[model samples]
Target: MPFAVYVLGLAVFAQGTSEFMLSGLVSSIAADLGVPLSAAGLLTSAFAVGMVIGAPLMALFSRTWPRRRALLFFLAVFVAVHIAGALTPGYGVLLATRFVGAIANAGFWAVALTAAVAMVPDRLKGRATAVVVGGVTIACVVGVPAGAVLGERWGWRAAFWAVAAVSLPAFLAILRSVPGGPRPEAVPAPVSVRDELRVLTGPRLRPTLLTMALVQGATFCAFSYLEPLLTRATGLGAARVPAALALFGAGAFLGVTAAGRYAERWPTAFVTYGMAALALGWSALALTAARPLAVLALIPLLGMLAFGTGTALITRVLALAPGAPTLAGAFSTSAFNLGAAVGPWAGGLALDAGLGHRAPVWVSAVLMASALAVAGVRRADGTVSGVRVT
Candidate 1:
């Protein structure tokens, strides 16, 4: 792999930390902002809404810009927004900052994936993409947990400040490392909006997009409430929750690594089985929430299965939309955020309805099952390309 690919991963790590750290800080944020817990949860949904809107729109807006330039521009916006988030005096302002920051996050991912894929060989595409996505896993492992600790000690604003501080170096790294040239041959040509829309909306790609939305919806439904679930259902103290979150991150890292090895060769089976495993994991989590040890054991597996499918699902979308890599990548990002938005919102509704912390787990299981069924139907219809396994 090119050194530049890992540099892209670093950028992802910076952005991902900001994206996911909110999960652990929701309670603190709720208390600080004087909002309901469910309202605090909407911070996640707000960020997702930004991503859903920004991914394709920014990708298209920057389609003509050099990849390196686009990346730097977006990273700068990301850093600026983090600073805004750190400094915001009101909950509404904080929410608005999250939305803008996510727009930057979405744009960064859309271009970064294009750039990362361009740096690798055909056979290495899956692994290269995994390496970039691995940054998110690492953030989950290190950044999110550390943010939790920071929020616990210094207030959630400290976590935002930290994310802003870290992003500067990532910006410098991209400036120093990534090339500032025309799109590589491996990258698809910039397509017209109509053409991109056609590719994105084609019959073969629709199911993959739907599956992406459903799977991520399932994952975040449970994940958005993981901290509360741990404390409430599993009897974990605040201090212990970060460690459990780290374990989940470790599982996600492992899942992405494993998926890189097989995603390209067995995209359909990988996605199908991965979603099934996620469903089973969430179902079991719902059943065992009262058992602290069992809950601890299952969290990592849940993270693993969710992210494992994520890597494959991205690869599958790229395959399905070979003519529009940026748009496809953007569309895929949108789908994931669509799920991100829906999951937490749905979970909040469940909580509002007096469903316990365990309710999100059940919601996750149903979503995963729905996603798996979609993948199964797609497979049966032979809509997925028959790429020969190496």
Candidate 2:
């Protein structure tokens, strides 16, 4: 892979950390500012909401800009949001800052990915894309957990401030490292709902979107409450949640790396089985009260199954999309965030219903199984190729 992939990875890591760290420190943030934990928790929701809004909206808006400028501009926005998050005083202000931040986050991904895919040669696109996504996976493994520790030590506000500091360097890395990407030579497409709708309505997109939405969606089911769930299982105090989160992240990293290596060769059948296994794992998490042992043993598998499917599913979509890889890529990311919205909201509802902590995990497990079913129907033998539009 080209060195630009690494720079992309770094920017991803910084953005991802900003996005997820709030989940771990929600209680602290709420207490510090005299708000309810639930209110504080909205930070995560804020980011997801941002992703949902930003994914399609930003994708449309960015069609005309030079890709490098778009990338840098969004990263700067991502950094500035973290600053706003750090410095903003009231709950309402914080919420507004995060919502705006999501806009930038969404745009950064849209443009970065559009650039990342275009920066590479055709044959290497799949692998190159994987390398870039690997940053998000790595962030899952490290960024959230590390941010948790930082929040715990320096305060949640401080954690956001630290991430804000990273933007400066990340921006520079983009200026120096990322290739003079495809924005220059490319003819900008006319942005229209009809254009995007036509892409979604295409034949092969059906199964591809289904596969990602379900499989990826299921992880959030378990992920949303992982901090508390594991804390109960492990019998650890709050301070230890970051370490557990880190372990889960490690599984994500390993799984993503393994996906790039074996997705081409295997039937990818095991990923569904992997989801089944994740369901069973969450079931174990639900059934056992020995929270410490269960979480330590089981949580990482959720990430493993989730990360492993990424390459297989993405390559499948790119193959399915044929001529419209950028739209397909944005759509895939859009689907993931859509799942992101569903996962936490589902978990939160379960928690609010007095269903006990494990309810969300179990429900998500079933969702994963559903995703597996969708994927199981896909003909692995029929490699979906990209469509070329004149």
Candidate 3:
């Protein structure tokens, strides 16, 4: 792997920290902003909505810009919004900042994913995706738990400031390591934006995109409420939540690592068994929510299955949309974040309906089951319709 791939991963770590940290900080944010918990949870949804809308739009608008330049520009906007979010006193102002920051973050993902894939050979695509997506797992492992501690000790604003501080180095690293030149040959040659858009909508790609959204939605439905589920329903102490989160992230890191090795060879298996296992895990989690030991044991397992499956689905999207890497990145990013948005909102509805914290876990299981059903569809030849898993 090129040193630049790691640099992009480092930048993703900074961005992903902010993206995932909100889950740990939601309670603190709700109290500080004098809003209901459900309202505070909407911050995550707002960010997801921004990503869903911004990815393709930003990709198209910045399509002609130098890759390095586009990345830096997006990172700068991301950092600036974190600072603004940290300083804002009103909840509306903070929410607006999150939305804008997500747009910037989505743009960065669009450019950076294309750049990372273009840097590697076809055989190494899965490994490259793992290296980039590993940043998110690491954020979940380190940055999110750290943010939780910071929010508990200081305020949620401190976590926002820390995200901005961490991102500055990424901005510098990207500036130094990523090239500012003509596009690499590994990238699909330039095509009309219309043509790229057409490829994105092709029959072969639609199911992959739908699967992306459903799988992600399923994973996040439980994840968004993990802290409350652990602290409130499982009888775990507040201090232990961070450790559980770390364990979950560790599982995700391991899953991504494993997927890098086997996903390309067995993408179908990854998607099929992974989602089925996730559904079972969440169902078990809901059933065992009151048992601290069982809850602790399951978190890491579910995290591993969820992310490993996600990495494979991503590899599939890229394969399906070979002619439009940037648009593919944008659309895949949108699909995942679309799930991110809906998952939390669905979880919130469960909470609002007087369902216990365990309700979201059941919701996750149902969502994953739906994802599995989508992925299970096959042709007469016993292969997935329009998909040739390599």
**Model 1 regions lying over 4 Å from their true place:** 26-40, 184-189, 383-390
lDDT of 3 at 128: 87
lDDT per residue for candidate 1 within 271-336, as digits (tens), equals 778887888889999999989899999988878888989988887787677778668879988998
Tell me the tens digit of each residue's lDDT in model 2 across 1-390: 777677877888888888777877889989888998778877778888888778767766766667777778888887877787788778888898888888888777766765676777766665666676788878777777778778888898888887887778878988887765455534565445565567766655776687677766777777778767766644678777766777777888777776666664552564555667766766777787465776676667767767777555765565555455346566777777878788777887888898877778877877777776765555442444433311
Worst 10 residues of 3 by lDDT: 378-387
Model 2: residues with Cα > 4 Å off, grouped in runs: 181-185, 188-193, 233-240, 266-273, 288-295, 376-390
lDDT of 2: 0.72
TM-scores of the models, in the order given? 0.92, 0.87, 0.92
- Predicted structure 1, TM vs. truth: 0.92
On the 0 to 100 scale, the lDDT of residue 161 in model 3 is 91
TM-score order of candidates, top first: 3, 1, 2
User: Per-residue CA lDDT of candidate 3, range 1-390, in tens?
Assistant: 988888888888988899988877989888888999989978987888899999999998788778999999999999999999999889999999999999999999888888888888988888888888889999999988788789989999999999999888888888888888866532456677888888988766777788889888888888888989999999888888878988999999999988888898887777788888998999999999999999899999989998998988887888778788569889988998899888877988999999888998889888888886766563222353544533
How many clashing pairs does model 2 include? Answer: 9
lDDT of 2 at 143: 75
